[model samples]
Target: MSTLTPGEQAVMSRFDLGWPESDIAADLSISFARTRAIISTFDSNPAHDRHREAQIRRGSQRLLARLRKAGGHR
Candidate 1:
């Protein structure tokens, strides 16, 4: 159960992907202050943390599979 709005989710997703706040703000076309404010207020829910961890694991697995298929792995 996410309490964040769609825009917030997008911001957080990019943030999780290691994007800088400036980059996120520029990409999203939002003000830097707004981006900082949103990030500052990010809540730490255990469920959300677990969900994000699972998503990262799944993405890593898929990337590894694609690399293997493309002979990109050593």
Candidate 2:
């Protein structure tokens, strides 16, 4: 799988947290158009669809990894 940029990762993080597109844009300091484009690109990517299905079965391990990276305890 291709690596996501930090901005893309931030967008996905907020999206998974149930934040709206506008809110994500505002919170991340990204333009709404760019945020929407990232979301649209992710939605259209077949790999992301497969990843989502896998995550649904396995739970959100990736979020845990992010937390760990940010110094959260395991």
Candidate 3:
């Protein structure tokens, strides 16, 4: 895959790190509405949607790893 932009990387990283959308928006200095709009645009395109799904899957894996490391759950 192509390298993501810094902003996209930040968004992906925040999501991968288990930050909520509101928190991500706050950290990125963006409004929640803008965040929602971005997500909507990502979802609306088939290719982008697939890419986002992969990102989410990767994020979920990272979250699971953190949980395991913390002995939180299975």
Candidate 4:
């Protein structure tokens, strides 16, 4: 919870992107059971919520930047 391991970050990113757990496992080269366990742990963490919120904020900022660049907004 203090810091996310690289695998955890990958799992979380794939999860957020709505990838199937099976695919996440295969892509991460982990067993499906272990993949589910890792994702479950990620889902249970408060840090996971924080991570999602941070990602949403970053996405919004990116959208605003694009809008400004296109003169869609001032």
- Residues 8-74, candidate 1: write the lDDT tens digits: 9888888888899999999999999998777655736577678778988999999999999999989
Number of clashes found in candidate 1: 0
- Model 1 scores a TM of 0.54
> In candidate 3, what are the lDDT values of residues 1-74, reduced to their tens digit?
56667876777677666688899899999888876655545333688788778999999999999999999975
lDDT of 3: 0.76
Q: What is the lDDT of candidate 2?
A: 0.83
Score residue 5 of candidate 3 by CA lDDT: 71
Error (Å) of candidate 4 at residue 58 is 40
Clashes of each: 0, 0, 0, 0
Question: Compared with the true structure, what per-residue lDDT tens digits does model 2 show for residues 15-58?
Answer: 87889999999998989999987986675578877876886656
Best by lDDT: 4
TM-score of each: 0.54, 0.56, 0.45, 0.55
C-alpha lDDT of all candidate models, in order: 0.85, 0.83, 0.76, 0.87
- Give the candidate number with the greatest TM-score: 2
| Residue 68 alpha-carbon offset, candidate 2, angstroms | 56
The parts of candidate 4 lying over 4 Å away from their true place are: 44-74
Question: Worst ten-residue run, lDDT, model 4?
Answer: 36-45
Off by over 4 Å in 1: 43-74
Candidate 4 RMSD computed on C-alpha atoms after optimal superposition onto the true structure: 11.0
